[model samples]
Target: MNYLKKILVYALPYKRYAILNIIFNILYALFGALSFVVLMPMLNILFGENHDVITEKPVLNGLNNIGGYLKDSLTYSIQTFAENDQLKALTFIIILVIVVFLLKNIFNYMALYFGTFLRNGILKDLRDTLYTKTVNLPISFFSEKRKGDIMSRIASDVNEVQNSFLSVLEIIVREPLSVIFSIAIMLTISVKLTLFVFVFIPTAGYIISVIAKRLRQQSADVQKEQGIFLSILEETLNGLKIIKGFNAQSLFNSKFTDSTKRFFNFSNKMMNRQNIATPLSEFLGIVTIAFLLWFGGRMVLIDKSLLASSFIAFMGLAYNILTPIKALSKANNNVKRGNAAAERVLEIIETTNPLEDIPNAISKTNFKTSIDINSISFKYEDDLVLKNFSLKVLKGKSVALVGQSGSGKSTIANLVTRFYDVNDGSITLDGDNIKSLTKHSLRNLMGLVTQDSILFNDSIKNNILLGKENATDKEIIDALKIANAWEFVKDLPREIETNIGDSGNKLSGGQKQRLSIARAVLKNPPIMILDEATSALDTESERLVQEALENMMKNRTSIIIAHRLSTIQNADLIVVMQKGEIAEQGTHAELILKNGVYKKLVDMQSFE
Candidate 1:
């Protein structure tokens, strides 16, 4: 019930539809009971043994006013029909039964009509809210979680909320109303028999409740198992090349099969529990009805206190109550399962994003003066990556950072981009603290070209345009020509429209690197950061791409994290780092003359 309260808030926007459905259900329930009441009069006329006292004036109880009105109207209509033929009276009763049945169905249709809008409305809101929350969550939230697990919450879990639980709203309004109205009719006919129904219903309800408790735990387990297999599938697709290279297909297949096998076992348990509720409740309800028939028959024959026709109508109404009760029991279990799914979805929705921008944060649109790294000490955990590191780059100057693999080159780039916040000290741009600037504005002023050629499965033209959304076709062509990518792009069957396939797989190692260069070239930002942009390429590709980088660096402020000493030979200042601190800093030629860490690295590369 607590879970239901939280989920019901998603339906608040469609209150009008919910109310209309309830109104229609109430009418359907009333008409359904009245239809069985009509049969009592017919049975009395056909089967009552004592016919001598039939001339007594009719006495209506609960429905006296309605009965009077209907009696007067039917009497007039019967008189008119009798003038034409004696058989018209039988025809009128048959027509009355048809009209009552029609009304019952009409309201039933109305209930379903409004229910469609209510159910669909909840589904749309739930999915939209889940997606909105996912985009707002912190990067750390995803770094520690699988993409497939998040996707499952959005796709399958939200779907379960709609399919399994939304129907509970219909049962809450429609079925229970139906059961109550039918029980009232049964009580009016024979209070003693109605008491027997009450005794049997609670016992069946208790059994169903016990089964439902296990459903929530089992349902949660099934959804979790589904996420595990989805994660394996996503991982396999992303790493297919590595798996094939290592011949690890059989290992992955077994892992995926194991996850799915667990899903099957848990699903079987949940279904078995859900399927048992319906039949068990029905069988118990039938037994109660059978007992009522025997008891009611004895009262009519032996005590002479009950009428035969009312007893027959009473039995029908009692049995009708059982259908709704049994349906409610089934809906209860569905609600439990759905509650488990809703809980998982809400967990993501309620997560707080740790990287959100502050209220009234200012935006930085231009750069002037210099970018200053001031006493910036940082660490991933206890092992410091940058220890009291500081540097300054004036506008339009180029500085290159050259170091071994563990010397914090990439970590410095990551901090400058604000992919993470510093644990200590401050990084300021043009005399303003970077943290005060909007994240979008800070990134907008700079462009990045990484070691890995991160191109999407898209056309060469589309991939380049990502650098600048509204860049003209002439500008894109010019950028490609600068990066020396135009030669290959023009040779493709469709030119710029030609598909690059996954991660630009159709291109050679050098071609992919040039495309990445073209993407950064088109951005044309005031600041540029190159993280070994041409390190992973053949000699020919390196020579061609190197010329493009030097051309891009002309009159632009840049921070280059380079591994190949040849790439940074012309850097205005070369900072050699060791153990997260600057070990040497000077011009490339000055560093080699010093014969420090920089000279050793240059000599090592010279030998290779």
Candidate 2:
């Protein structure tokens, strides 16, 4: 319930709907109880216990007397009927019971009808907020988490909260009120009997509550375990190639099975506990009803304080309380289960985004002189990847980073584009600290071409349009031509409209890389960062793509991370890195003359 209270902000928008539902529910409760009460007078007349009044005048009190007058007039009419034909009065009582029961159900239906708006309104707003939060959250938040787990939280967990927990609000409010109204009428007829009924309820309630105490925790565990297995499933599908290549299908199979087995065990315990609640509470309610029949029957027959018809009406009221009691007990379990889901969802909504814009951050729309990396140091964990690494790239000059694997070439591109921030020192653009600029504005000045294409399962035109939403067909074709992808795209059945399957799997390795470069080219930013852009291609494809890359680099400040030392020989400046520090720096010819690490690497390749 405390968790529910936290989520109440979502309900504020639909307060009017809630108010209307409550009004109708109150009327439904009142009429539902009154229907049983009306049965008592009808029973009395039929049994000949109370002869109907022959009233000629009525005692009145303002408008309030209207009810008494109607009762008196009905009593006189019944007397007239009984004198003429006794069977007719009996027929009228049965008709009256039927009418009251009809009205009771009518109002109940109306209460539920209005409640639909509030229920669905909460669901729509909650899903919307969850989606919005997912988009605005930082990239780093996803680094340590599984994509499948997040998807499960958004889809299944939210649905559980709605179907199971939110339904309880209606049962808690409307059903309990009906029970209260019924109990009040029962007490009015016989306070002593009602008081006796109360004693049995608390004992039954205590036993049910004790069993339900740990149910919320168990539900939470079950949901979390489900997320674990869902994550494992997602990982297996995404990395199927790696698993098969390494002959590790059995390894992933065992991991997935283990996760599902734990989920199965947890789910079994949660459902078993929930299933027991309904039958156990109902059994206890039946026992209480039996005790009431014995005790109340003795009072009516021997004690002489209770009438036969009134005792019958009281039994109806007692039976009515049992249904609500059982319903509320089941709803209580639902609320607890919902509480578990709500807590998980709320954790996400309440979590603070570590990366946020400064209040006064400026927008950097253009690069003036150069990008400067001043003594920047960073690490993913304890082991540092870059230490006091400094570099400079003047406007329109090409700078290439050439090194062995894990030499922090890609990290430089990441920091310059603000995909990540440096742990120490600063990276600045045109003499202004990159952190001082808005992230959106800082990233807009640069375009990136990674080794992986990162294409979506979308049309070719739509994928290229991602670079610039309002780009024209001509512009897209021009970018494609520059990337050397236009040739294949023009040959496709739908041409630009052709659908690229998941991660562009429908295309060849070279084709996907060309499409990636086309996207960056379409952006046409002032600076470009190519992180081993041609590393994954064959020799023939690399030669063609490298030519396309050179054309795109014209008149732009480019930072290239190169795997082939020969490809960067013509670069204006080549940075040689070894173990997170500068090992050599100069033109490729100068580095080869130095006969250091760069010379050894070049000689190993045996540059002709």
Candidate 3:
């Protein structure tokens, strides 16, 4: 319930709609009860029972006897207006009932109408907030979480919260007020009968609550299993090629089937518990009515204390009370189910990001002098990946880091991009600590071209525009030409306007790499970081991408991390890394002459 209250904060901007819905619901409940009570005189006239011949209106002596006064006043009005005409009296009563019923329905529709805005508005705002949070969270947050599970919280769980929030509104406002108005009218008709009605209420509520209490955990299990199968589906779709190649369709299918079995069982148990609500409430209501008939019938027939018409109308009002009570019991169960979803949705929205920009952080727009990494230490787990390692990249110089796998070459790229901050020590740009600068401005100083050639499903112009949002067609063509990609791009169907498929899969690996370089070339940052950008291409493709990288690297502070030793042979300095620390650093020719760790790496690549 607290989590639901937290979720309601999204409804603040649409508070006017919520307020209107509540006002209309109050009117709906008031008239809904009055519609049943107004029929007492009509029943009396139809059956020729409880008719009073009064010519004068009764005075309300005090607030306590207003019920008696109202009842008497209704009798006096009928007698005077009828003037001994039976059909005319009946006609007036029917018209009165229609008026009350009409108002009730109109209010009910108005309540639903305003509520539509509140419900959908909160839903849209909540999902939008969840997506923004997902994107703004640090890179390490996604590494430890499943993409499919996050998608479930954003899509499925937020929808559940929207539905449950509506239930909360009914449970707190509309349903209870309907019951209260009905019960208040019941008391005016007969206090003893209404008191008897109270005895059965707490018992019925307790039984319904017992069933609802067990529904929440079961609902949570169903939602969790839903996320699991969705993860399996996402994985299967992403790796469909490899799965089909290995003939492992049955394995993934088994995983999906097993998850659905658990989901099926969980859903059955939860719905079974939830389904008991209506029938159980109906049964209890009938039982209460049966007792009232016996007790109320005795007062009319044997004791002569209550009228026949009053008893019948009292019965109608009691049944009206049961209607809202039944809805209330069902609504209670809904709140419990929605509470689970609210917890999941709010969990992501409320997550504390440790990598958020510091208070009063400066925004650095330009890079000069050098980037100094002073004895930084970091670890993804218990084992350190970079231990007290330090290096300095001066302006307009290219430094290549050559290392084997697991030697932390890529970690340097991640740290330099500020995807994850160093656990100890600091990285500075031109003597200003990177942490003291806002992330947006800090990242604006560099361009990155990674191993995967990350691109979106958009036109080539749009993809390049990601680097410079306001860049022109001339700028895009110049960048493509500089990266040596314009030669192939010009022969395409739409050239710069061509639509690349998902993740740029429409282009070959070399073409994708060259496009990535073109994107970075458009940005024209002071510093460039290329993380094995040409590692996966064929020989001819590698030569073309290498030439593009060489062109882009000139006059920029570039850090090139490479697995192939041939790529870094012409770099100003090649630093050989054995573990987390540097093993050797020198010019390629100088390191070859020394016959040290650099020579060993070059010899291995040559032997292969």
Top-scoring candidate (TM-score): 3
Residue-by-residue lDDT tens digits, candidate 3, 1-608: 88899988899999999999999999999998898778988888877875557767799899778678878888788878888588988898899999999999999999999988998999999999999999999999988887888888888888988888778889989999998998888888889888988888888888888888888899889888888888899899888989999999999999999999999999999999999989998999899899889999999999998878888988988888889888888888888888998988888899999889999999998998999999998898889998888999999989999888999899999999899999999999999999899989988999999999999999999999988999999999999999999999999999999999988989999999999999999999999999999899998999899999999998999999998777887888788886788898988899999998888888888933
Q: Cα lDDT of all candidates, in order?
A: 0.83, 0.84, 0.90
- The digit string of per-residue lDDT tens for model 2 on 1-77 reads 88877877887898887777888888888888878777876787767766545646455567535544545665666
Task: Give me candidate 3's TM-score against the actual structure.
Answer: 0.97
Candidate 1 clash pair list = none
Error of 3 at 540 (Å): 1.3
lDDT of 2: 0.84
TM-score for all models, in order of appearance: 0.89, 0.92, 0.97
Across residues 1-608, which tens digit of lDDT does each residue of candidate 1 receive?
A: 56656878888898898888889888998888878877754564467432332223445555625434343344445445544343565466567778988999999998878878887888899889988888767555777778888889888888888776445764777778888888877766667777877887788778778877789899999998888899999999989999999999999999999999999999999999999888888788878888787888887888877888778888888877887778788788877778889888888877776556778777999889888999888887679999999999889989999899989988888889887778889999998888888888999999898999999999988999999999998999899998988998898999888899998888898999888888889999899999998889888999999998888888899999998889898999889988789999999889989998888998889833
How many angstroms is residue 185 displaced in model 3 relative to the true structure, after the best TM-score fit? 0.6
Ranking by TM-score: 3, 2, 1
* Clash tally for model 1: 0
